[model samples]
Target chain A: MGFKRKRNDKEGDDDAGEEVREVSHTVKKSHVLPSSIKNKDQRSAVYAKIKQEKKRDKIKKTRARDAAEKKALELGEELPPKKVPRTIENTRELDETVCKPDDEELFAGHDADEFSSIIKRDSIPKILITTCRFNSTRGPAFISELLSVIPNAHYFKRGTYDLKKIVEYANNKDFTSIVVVHTNRREPDALVIIALPEGPTAHFKLSKLVLRKDIKGHGNPTGHTPELILNNFTTRLGNRVGRMIHSLFPQNPNFKGRRVVTFHNQRDFIFFRHHRYIFEQKETKQSDTKGKKVKEAKDEKSTFKGKTIARLQECGPRFTLKLRSLQHGTFDTKGGEYEWVHKAEMDTSRRRFFL
Target chain B: MPRSSTVECGGCPPFRALSFDVLGLIKVIEARGGQQGNTPKIVERWGEPDASRCIVAVSINDRQNNPLVAVGRKNGEIELLSATNGDRRAAVIAEGGAIASMHLFKKEQSELSSRSCTLLTCTINGKAMLRSIEITNSSSDSNSTDDPSTTWNVCSAGTILCSSVDGNEKYALFGGKGVELNMWDLEKRDKNWSAKSPPKNNLDIFTPTWFTSAAFLDKDDHRKVVVGTNSHQVRLYDISAQRRPVISVDFRESPIKAVIGDLDGNTIYFGTGSGDLASVDMRTGKILGCFVGKCSGSIRSIVRHPEFPVIASCGLDGYLRVWDLKSRDLLSAVFLKQQLTNVVLDTNFSGEEPTSAAANSSPNDANAVMENQDEEDTLGPVKRKKSSKDNKQSKKHRKSKKKLEEEDDD
Candidate 1:
């Protein structure tokens, strides 16, 4: 009895456990491997054809693979598997770094070619303007001019004829910094700088001395020689301005260094600055080098002795923020203290800061 | 190393930002049960009044309501118990046909002591019976007027698989020979609305089974009936729209049970065949982010507290887990060593404090105390059993301590 067997892999398949016909199941003896090989040349030809087909298929697959890889490399992306679509959850996470300020990135908007003057806080940002008379309009004009230059600067409204009121406010009310403006004809024509211990308070006294006596009536030094007076005035103003520039910005807790320019007249200017404290360096020789030049210069432009820029050298006992360099003469006749930050410090952007 | 120096120069804070923990899982207790394939015999293992059986559905009634916990078992037996003392007050209230589902009504105290509540039980044998029990305290001296048990023939069809009772005593029936959702208004004692699922693919050959869990959502403005099907989907149908479900959510797992409650049934908590308990926002049709974990067994039943937005659920896995609906977080869990076919919580228990704000504040904060006091007041005098005098004293002390702590934070 001949029967056929059935595959029962899926549902609704009724045929199973059946016997197969002997004629269909029996192997054809003439088609066996040995018998097929008896016709050697024909069999060899068939084998060659199969081998050629295999090689062609392999080469095609390799070419396709190479082409796909080359395209992926050119596009800066790897080919994803030919499957499901991607979702937002598959993207890379975001960087969480916060940005901060950098010294080289200060005045980001300005040109960088010019040599920038770096400023540090020597003391609170303060300045005083003294003239010949209280109502000479020079003192008021100067006060207004300084206010116009830095809108945040404080003016005490003290008398040039009398320095007591200015001194009392500076000492008692805890002002950030003090400036004393006195006429050139008064005694003690000297610019003084007094440093306070802890609190933001400094005492200053500016006294002007008579240079030449009047030879005419009343014998009062009214019409003094302009040369001597101008020389003395410029000298004293230069020293006082230098000292004031060395003060700190009162409100800044992180004050490090500063660049200061003091203008007295059209011909003379005083430049004093404080640099960031380098705690480990031996600073004795540096401070002496700057001080000696200032003393020797007197009124004339002290010869640049190549003794390094007259920097306000730091003494380590304190967080000695001192002058880094000094260049005195007249500034570009800008007629005002041009306040601008250094280009290098201003160029840093938030993106570059993180990088 | 030098890069670190550059970072130091930039003056960045030496610490990381803050983070908060969302899920507060205090404890986890496992119950006894094994994963097994679906079979009629396996399903029958739960219907007995054995504590080892899974507690499928749970509910805690308000103090004034004094609701009872009616647990429907896999074997089609229901056990009514008192939630307050964990006492099995009624051993076998009803038995016989394979129980597809059951629910106990929210009742007033007068109704509670008098058993003036309706309990709806559905069977796989195409029978839906509404049993009204006039509960009488055996310890009480008062004479009971009404009969203790009364049975009403609600509906008869193929398996009367799922049934839901609304606040108005309306019964919504889901399973039968057809995919049609049928509602029987218990108030009117008649079938009001019905909807049928369209035939599709392989499912088209037979009418879709009735929803195992169904409820009326947003009962205030728009009355929407939400039904959970055996096919693992949650469908919402506006009663105003000829009973056709308006939204169907593929919840990914079969929602074996569902309930609507809390401020117009805006929140819906349901369980899955995979022992997963989840909630849905009916208004938005969005799944509230539920803290993920498995109950000891497949959640066979679920019920919401009558007053508070809390849910009590039980599973074939034998564990009973309580959930906070709004937060969708597991609040507490109790292990029932045996498969919990049905579970219920009595709402008579005190409410838990709203912890989000107070969670960060010191316990003694005066504002927290005042806020809690305000909540107590809102709960009404009948809810808080403590005398007013004691509450006032405790309030004062708490306020003072909180004030002191606030000063410290400042």
Candidate 2:
């Protein structure tokens, strides 16, 4: 009786195994069952063949889908919608080409216009001059000198080197340039200038720096606001013109004198030719009387000794500046060629250190 | 009475299971289980050589219950890969500008017999497209078959930097550098929604100018959108009531790179360019906590694990770190050796783990090993305990010698 019951149990187990296999086969398309009533080795071999067939079938289906997508694209037809749009606007109609420019070409000239605007010298840039507080002795004097030279410049005592905060401050105040004097020990070592709003910061090494006391200068600054200001001076010709105008200012101003000219240095390049009002007397040809021609003229001249006065007039030079290439930071011969206004060798004969 | 009965047994003998050491060890084991032991391992990495073409957007969807990860590149290329084995499933080129954002949604009820998935992609130039994917698997016949098809549609044409769809996929929001926050009703297919302007604050003279990222809160009934601005402000807007943000909070003092909210919508997590990841309680406007360690660059993406109390983040530093939310401990950090812009986790991904080439020799692993050595050197208690025993023995010997000397004198 035990043997008979064991046989029944074995049959029941076999039935359950068959049911599980059937269910797995039905659920997974990749799973395949051997059909031949043969040896286990032969059944396994058939299953392997089924697996390979399924893989090949999958590859074939994928290829077909790819081909169909390509064909639909070529025909310029909209592919079927994935989701039924609840609103008409959500349904995308493929009307434009999918192909786009390559990355290199896409980003190549993206900021071309913006760059042109940034480098364009449209007006006199407002400058913010600052000095590192660590070298207070030398930095303050240098910063003060710079502030006096540049009209729109203001002095900023840097407490910390937080670039973000400095930039934020500049942006709020609408400063167009930021010049920071970095000192080593007790001497100024480098001048760091950044074009404000955005930046292409330039660092210039300092050497042979002569303070105002070392150079022959106007006894006192005129403190005059020029009626006209020339900005972003470029080329040797502009330098000559700037130097000639700078020479017109008197070494010392009379207490009552209001007319003055200023030449400011920025980014190593000199931006110059600012001036105030100047008055001149009109010239009149000296009149000679016919009665003075003869010897008796001496006697007549004594009677006409009291002369007539000429008319006084106001006059000044009127010239407009045509902006060309904008000079970036201070003039440095060893810097990048693109940073300079003139890439070729400059005419050094025209260079003047006075301004 | 129960306590008195236990006292009758002579103050219950120490229960081994109730010991502090056993409980502490159990807690540590549980933590380990929740960390690297059970967290989804990065099975594969598809790295791009040029870091400039880093991934700009990522979308994960289950098509016919098969996980698919789609990544959009800076060069306007969209790559779809299988989440299981990282197999290349499909590649689509959407040309105009770099892909700015991507969203994947599964249709609730499809007329077609097969399940359908939809992909919505937006380019930086404001062009948006919707692609439909259908997976067909038929097992009725003796021969098994599988087929996949895709359809494309143009949704909007303009410039968009970031875009997101609501939970029900009903409304879409788009914002960027110059564009103001705009909402579109997906059902009506129009931008007729009225929005209220942000209230003016005397302290902030300049309006929030540039919006970097935005996300929809996960609340179904109350529709809210959170926007992160370049000015380091996170603003929460209630769509139904007003156009302006109801609450504006200043986050880390750097531009916010990414923003996401918890499932309950009460806690919001934000990452900044300064490599700070912090969470804030929305109800009281209080900063809950910060996740610290190993993030040295701008965090590009932060994704919370759906099942675990951990968050995975990748940033400009190129390290993918998982932080435990409760313990605030770094679980695992893997260095990809390339600047990574985005990461997506496959919540339902269950497959044979694919060996990662970088994971075996990652610098993060070496650093972790070094850290463990340093910790052992500084805090090892075994050496201290041994030294204390030696000192005790030395003291006893000295005391016995003194006593002997006294006895000799007596």
Candidate 3:
């Protein structure tokens, strides 16, 4: 034997007590650092060698796994189960208030809720968009974009009139809802959506707003009603908020416009996006890879030709909204009862999600 | 704060009928676990799917050993339903203008144990009428049950915002927008005393006298009243002293929608539009604290159990929450599925109520009597025995649990 080693150092290795390689006639070098090594330079060199060996071992293990997978596929065996990574959403706490799909009570309640009339198409939603009392330069531009995004929406000037008076006027006008843009330092930072007449108002703290001119390769929105897509609004409170937003749009969507608006709520942060989608046939490598999985599953090595897939192009005015509070009725700054209030104390746990 | 893991309603007063006014229905939950343990089962469901008859106000009179609940609909109709079963015992068309409030009580001169009950209902436009229900025959069938008569109007002020009866039912307090707090003598049908609006604030802004909810502070005295305003202030009015509030406390920024008095007169429980259920010390004018369970909508009704340390709250959130008064913790909560307009607990909810607590000195005596009633319930002994063994612990739950288990053990 070329060398001798302590049995405990390489205890976990399967080939530990095997005979030394006949060609080399030598034992493997253990990557353990000796405590007696006093010199800093020698310790640094040993550490570097150990790190390199560990990297090589990891790469070798992955290579072996790949080889085994390839062999298994060639032998027509089942593929190994994929490893699932743990995420905050996957391990979120159980929310008791989550509305089940078939909850008749919740469904029956929705049929008689505040937004029911508008949502049921019994009355069309006529939105009166207005800015706060204070003037801001970009506020007009944002309001204009909002007008384009929502069907049957009109802009009202932010004069000296109070919100309660405005709401009363809107009620007389039979406007279905009111959207007030709150600006701070010349930027629209908040959006208040108040259902008209007998009201339930939602105040949203807006962030990361990108207007039509700001987004690159953004398309212009048309007058046709865009389809609404609400995602991840599962909780009871979320259901109410989702309905409030849902009633803002017209019932029948003009699919010909090819425009779509999405309110995606993930971890309670609503992401608003407007896009124009087109379904076209494209014979590219990307589509070929998708077909490969199908062909591989059937054990038929056939090539896929032209495939039609839907593609989306951004239609501007993208933003994120976090609900600050949802008030029961109209816009009474003083005494309106809030349906849901976002307090700092609610976020005590990282994995707890309301929506 | 940790949520209470167990429902503390096991040792509750015999009045275990917890009925919540859902959209068009009144759903009753058996809180005493008569048939179900731990889980409070829905014993009876009242009301139909008729949209025209939406419920607005509910008053349950289970106090005088009567299982009758008075339900006021939006069409200004009051229907008396059997609390035990969901049958229509009687229905009367009270002044039609959309019912604002309703109360079921016996006449002040009538005996406490009298079976004859009076119904008081008011409309939004301030038209109130009373219909006394007197059973024509003692063994009356469902078809011919009640003969209602003595209908009279007690209209005081128009656009009535809030109205409440004190413990003695001698005076009724009424307040509304632009209307000052007015106390009406129910017996004499005359105005006794009216509140004077407070002076303007430092900014010369007049706090609108829009009382969203009001309650008599003491069950025994009709002088002390707690009024919640649309302006989000809780005013404590001592009518014996001044016409204005003795102490006005602001709770958050939401309008107080429900006002109620606790066992002690000083502690008042209130629920704001923002779903904050908190107690305030009337003497010191300081907020005690908000209850642990968060409500998701404006609270419409908050009723404390007459003889127990528990309160039930319901509102637009459609959830009826029963909270322990001593610990200020949510003991049991149930989702009624409709935007709840009101919630009422049967003071003598179950068979647990002592048939004769005439010589009763403490609540413990009532609990001891409850043990004799629920002895046959096999499940009762298991729960009560566990509680009795853990009596050494100072936990309110254990005390309540021990109380639920009678000293006259099976």
Candidate 4:
């Protein structure tokens, strides 16, 4: 070992002495790009060579680790712990509004929230869907798609009516919620969700819409209620928004329909997606199979009941919604007080998120 | 509460016997605290960090019940506690979704029982109820709404965002977005007057009318009221003059969230939705300069110490800030961790715990206030307790949320 170390040091000294362009004192000398090679073409060639060398070195290290792991397995030893890569999500700033599982106050609040009656199946959800009075483009088409997506939703044309009067009309008619799809120019640009009777109106900026016809191989949705899935709604505001959205759908979903709807929130943007899940049987990899797995795969290849593999088929009309403001009451835009308003100044830090 | 063992600002009880002077501590950091920055030394904070529910409504104790504060949480639970030491005495369950406002006032039923404290709470659902409290000789008090009380639905065209009782406690005013300012005569149990919308501007566009905050201009005259609108306008209304506001003044662009009048009646302090807190001369309809220090979030509540020359403001910024009223300097600031919906000053906090802290009693040296060192105890206040959480060390206390109807005494 001493002889190998002595020879490697002598080789390093000889290389540093020959490489005269840049003078540096880092422990490792191989990684530094030669500053003296000022020629653009030469520097590019040297950079490509270094990149290839680094790629090869990484592959070699992974191969060595795999070999060691195989040897350990053969000797019936413990495997190395998995290394977790650091990402922005994993290193998110601490948010005080995040909900805890056993928070009694939060649970109590949930019991009394506006959506509680509908979500608990005490009363059926009655949603009234409408477009702004002067909606253009695919507004009607979007409303039709939404009518099918949401259970027990009725289409109500705005028809040059004041929003307050509409809200009053809906209140008299016993509508649980009202969804106003606002279109600007030629596209749906905003959405207003107002919980009825007692309200907290949520305004959202709609963008990146993709109609079902736009998506290739999109499956047609069935009349059966779609199972709703909400993800990453952990903050207080997010929880309230989730509840408002949840109340729009029927509580009793027919699982036999295999239809699914998802609202996934990431970095304050909520992505809406619709899909149908199908259970598929796994195709056996006989070459890699060692025992019972091969036999089970072969036996139940045609059957779907015992299959664990699930596949999602996209059923479209997907869009992204970003919360613009949450008003304390119904759609009185001119005078309503906003519970939380998104302002240009609020986006001071990229890591700081309200929802 | 004794000095639990004072070790140079180590541990001070929430209320009285603060081991260290708060101003001295802030003076230590004043060099770094920055001028006009959040520099006030916080003497007391009510709740813990990360509590499930934040304080939505707070009413200062009446002078007779000095230092005993009535706090309403978002989940509709009101707890009566000691302002200085954080000792909870009783609790009440209010309903109709998040408490929108709470007012502590003196309800004089008859000439016999001169002054009885009444607590009125209004929820977002427009349910308003007034509960009168009684002090029993035996140390056990129970009240119920059945005997005789006031409970009514506001039935506002829009959601009721805020309601305020005059300093004289004779009337209550309510206003919100789409809801005009309506005054109710407490004695008559009827509407006294309602505001009229102003005529359309030169462009013939009717200006939006929404009252975010309103306050009585004088302690003796309930007719004169100062209102802050969501349109960023501050209007002074004199009921004796006309249904419309007498003096109209427009402040900064953001909607006004809180409005409070200084003792002078004409001088008003209003905090805007954009976290700008400034004073306005009501009589002249002139804009006074802004108070020093900036709040990161919208301002929700503002309180003036009746005895002290200080003002404390808190809001969505989650900070409790105390400012020198005269100098407009940020005397002290403390981040309470949870976004504060309302703040109330305990005027008689300078007195010991037994005397009770009075509201509206301003003192010069409010810096003597301190915090509760148990730190962990604040978590309990966040959760609604159905049973009266009688301080085990103290004698028997009032039952949770009992309304004492004057019938018992009559």
Candidate 5:
């Protein structure tokens, strides 16, 4: 049976070699075999030679083994046990150990007192917008649009600035945040927002982004900041409100208007809306023509009215901002937690005065 | 740890989903609709619990517009199961060793008016065997007569960790622990390259680096291969352009375990040993974002929905979670209660009916109100229906969890 199997295997090898030679003439003959056998006789001769070579190799191996065994017997020593094949357990220790970051290391270099003090100070945040070089062409339009809403924002062209240099420049200029827009296939996919001076870099995946002009406007800009800012948004709701508030601020501050509203975030939640308050007179009540006409006339009355009411209303586009990370001081690169607390359930009934 | 004994998203209806664990046990889950929570029900259970014969790799082929799941086992056995019914269709044995990876491709010949499906199974010892499954007739009853012809070639002499066939089924790529990336032409049945080592950097290192996972960029014309190394580096090689990698970027400190490219070929999603799944732009190497929640173990497999913007992933944590790629929000999470090694989504199974039903119904409906009241009663009946073998397994899982917690405390 063994001899027959060997003959079959030799035939298979010859067939495979012939197929390869037929398909590709560039294949070197030496690589397949010493030389190509032209006829059946030559092939049989080559197979006989191969068989003889294998027999010789087996004889040599057996002679060597027998000699070693005789020597061991002469020395009155038992032959060594057969070698064991290595298993997976043998290489199990090759796996590298992973280092996990702890809370103390993440919050290093910053004290509780300093963090609280920094949080308490309510200053106008200056933001610098940096676009990734690969998406520079579309970055300008996005920057200009973002500037229309954020008065303190400035655009930094790509290739002219490096991340380290820009961070240092922002630190020197006392910029509060640096927003980097990363594009995938020339489309804006994410925003990496880093809080300046001290660090808390947040990475947010952007989706469903719409320009301020695209979203229907309810009322014109008040041209005056609100006296009191109300922030009642939490979790994902707060994220949306934060994005909307980000778009409300103009690129260039309106000194003549002197009125601005800002939504600040704390601990992954929007804390409150801040604005300068301005008083306005209420409009006089007009006849309820639409309501009366709907009730009296057979035809349905349109819900439109000629008279308008002059009342204070929250103004701006609503946007959702996802908080990604919270870091400590500027230079502690690894000292930050990327995980944020997410609410298990959304409370739709929560008080949200500013939609 | 199990929390509250109730599933989240109570108002959502159940969808048909399947998950398998390291013990070779496959569980089919049906989502429930209720106000108390959307608890998943085990609709079916199959596969044996043998430690030595665990499943290592799995792939779902919907090429013929019908879903067929190919499961590879640790003992070098490949089993084909019907996606809709979980019935065993066929089985084949390859060279002895654990099956490392599997890919399904379809070969159609217009002249013969015949279509044949090919199953590529790569063993840990670096033998890639291609099995041709020929359907004799279109009728379901004739499926048993399907003949499977296998042809195998040695892609490498060492362990292979990952393997995949190109979109056109013309080329196949395989890489593993000690082997550099290698490509084989399916038509020629020969290696396309002679390079024995991967593209090297200027840093002098004597030892050869190993690849943990690899994927083709999905562009037939580009012929680019992206591989994630054990050294936390992602390298892209254009075979036609150069022998070395054209671009290489260090992703993170953790070893990447699985990788897949997006449809557009400009973005690549990778999962690491530390349970981080993120995407990076292929052109600029900028990380788009990371998907968060329910990822507590090293990710093993990630499959993106062909039509939807959702990606399903399974890992050692024994949970299969789906996430929206655009928003990076977890859409759903199912606890399969086993160390999951691989997962593949059945794209042909449209979950619209169940999902839409759950979405359309209001939480205040009378049916939901009644179901919430009797939620405990339903749980008792289901528990009683489970076989004694499954009951023992569940108890073992609980005991293991308790032991893990005790170790953590110590």
Candidate 6:
């Protein structure tokens, strides 16, 4: 009995100790979050991923809504119900092929020669990108892509009428020539590319190009009228480019003593003598005379007689581009009966493209 | 009746001999010799590397009945220190900015395990963070696990709450520009809900850069909020109305540092930055009385005792003054080298064995009692015979009671 009593006591003592330990252990484990949610880092990552996905979906919906509205407005349909703008809408559709490598074939073997050497000899080609601002991410993407395709060529993004940042990039001595893809009317936004040369010598040279007379309206005049301003800027830009090349190669070091010549077309194109390009004008296919050569052997005197009837009708001012001392013979597109303007009119013609 | 009972100060007999001085800073001077024992010097020092520039406001945490000081620093750092030992036990850093105001909720022993005790800290850059650190100790584990501190940014509406309290899941933050009071919750960490207060647009016409103070006035059947503005005005907000303030009162000539004094939920003491102290009836919005106190500088903090009718005030002048309501006289003044942004007395031991040597009224007072008690207790055997005579008187009374019972039966 004594032995049994002692054994019972020992058993009780062991049970008591185990109970205390178990109670404390249970309490310690109970306060913590469940095992499934223990890893906060993983949970937060998943939460952020979900949030990003939601934002993307919202943007897509907003874009679709905007596109539908734009289409409805074009069709003259009733507007959609009004609502606050929730997500940002993507307005511009990216056309990758519009500025891609179809021109690469023109410069296939030109990689062996330096860009300056080839460009001086009228061998290397240039690709022009029309842009209103350098801030757009798309503008950078377009330039980088075109540069990858066309080697030994300069990529010009139509700069705003301020030429500072653009002039810095183009005047780096590495570039062959920066072609501002601009129309010579309406103060072409592209002249900004030519206006802002950043170097100390560039400021002095550009001061001569500033319009001396202030126009009555928009007193801060780039030139005189919007059309004249564009034309004058283009002309001045051409002169500066010629001076830069002249200073670079004093006697046409690579071009066998050929001097840079400038020319303009009725389409408002300003190209140098050495810079040859494939001019592909996309025309409205309004007529079915698709395979005919439309060039007519009419001189300036004959053209004036042909437009005599229209002039008598007094429809509107017939704008024209005038050129002085043509250096090269001009070519026309093979098409039908379309009114054609001579490249000379690019400088002096008062006529403009109505559409 | 004995005028003062021989209250047990821990196992030792109660001795009244502590003296406190409040000049430029708080200095606790203890008597060298006492009947019980010599009391140790009590000093509580706070602040870190950037103590001078970083500290903006300080408040006493009298709820714990212990000397817990809440300090808000310029870098939005909050620290709760053990006032007895000057140990930085709990520290919190909010988003970087200058801390505008701070308050520490009293911890209840029954709910000690709960993460309900919160430090509401506000920054000048329009941010309010309610930080809670829950300390849990289990009987089974000798090793303790301190829960990681959680802080929630409470100001998303470009507004800061002057005073905020978290109870259970419901938390109320009151005061913003234009008298806009908001009561929100940690449970709804997404946003702050507008907790309605009276004359809702009181601040609409008047723009105040600072609100003096705020307190929860009525919580029984009706939840109410009280806010004091720099314009010497107090506004009471009823949560149920969801509209303008229930009542408003112009109670001070200067900004009031308001504090709730009683569990009865009626008494509130407002200490002004200009040395004006006012007590107001929360129910009626009437000024009960006002007094001028020792405030050589702007009063930065005011806190009432948790269990006693005692009020402690500290200011930029580097002095901490304690007031006894019964006498309306200065109880003690502690002189500190640095400005007293806050001052809190440790009353946790007020009910416990008073081991605090600083509690003696004067050094001589403490020495006299300690020596007397030591001598009396050591001669305990001699007193036993005297105590035995008192026991015999009790026996005599019992014998008489038996005789009286027998005579009544006859």
lDDT of each: 0.42, 0.53, 0.75, 0.69, 0.59, 0.43
- State model 6's lDDT: 0.43
Candidate 3 chain A, poorest ten consecutive residues by summed lDDT = A1-10
When sorted by TM-score, best at the front, the candidate numbers are 3, 4, 5, 2, 6, 1
Candidate 4, superposed: residue stretches over 4 Å from native: A1-37, A283-308, B1-58, B62-66, B70-133, B137-139, B143-200, B203-212, B216-225, B237-246, B251-257, B262-267, B271-300, B305-341, B348-410
Model 5 residue A303 CA deviation (Å) reads 93
| Candidate 4: residue B282 lDDT (0-100) | 80
Q: Point out where model 2 deviates above 4 Å.
A: A1-355, B1-43, B51-53, B62-64, B112-116, B133-159, B192-194, B350-410
Please report the candidate that would top DockQ against the real structure.
Answer: 3
Tens digits of per-residue lDDT, candidate 3, B268-314, equal 99998878889999999998888966556789889988766878888
- In the range A1-355, model 4's lDDT, one tens digit per residue, is 4433453465567668665454343324444455557898888887787668567767988998999899889999998766798665556666656778876546656775678899899999999998887876698888888988998999998999988998999999999999999999869999999999877898999999999999999999999999999999887778889999999999999999999999999988999999999975445333145365766655655663444568888888999999988876688765455556776655545666667
C-alpha DockQ for predicted model 2: 0.01
> What does DockQ come to for candidate 5?
0.01
Question: Looking at every candidate separately, what fraction of the true A–B Cα contacts under 8 Å does it contain?
Answer: 0.00, 0.00, 0.51, 0.03, 0.00, 0.00
CA RMSD of all predictions: 38.3, 37.1, 8.7, 12.8, 36.8, 38.7
By TM-score, the better pick of 5 and 6 is 5
Number of the candidate with higher TM-score, 2 or 5: 5
Model 5 interface RMSD, in angstroms?
18.1
Report the TM-score of chain B alone for all candidates.
0.59, 0.68, 0.78, 0.70, 0.75, 0.63
Clashes of each: 70, 10, 7, 25, 23, 55
lDDT of 2 by residue, B1-410 (tens): 01110001111111100000100000000111211133323323333234334466877775446676666765666666555555555666676667888887655546544344567777776666666544323322222122332323223433456677877787777787766777776656567443455656788665645678888877463378887877788888777777777788887566777888778777878887667788877777788888866355567778776645667777654456677777566655554433456766556432112112222333236465455445545543434544665588688899999999999999
The candidates' DockQ values read 0.00, 0.01, 0.33, 0.03, 0.01, 0.00
Query: Candidate 3: misplaced stretches above 4 Å?
Result: A1-81, A284-304, B1-19, B31-44, B48-52, B106-116, B134-158, B350-410
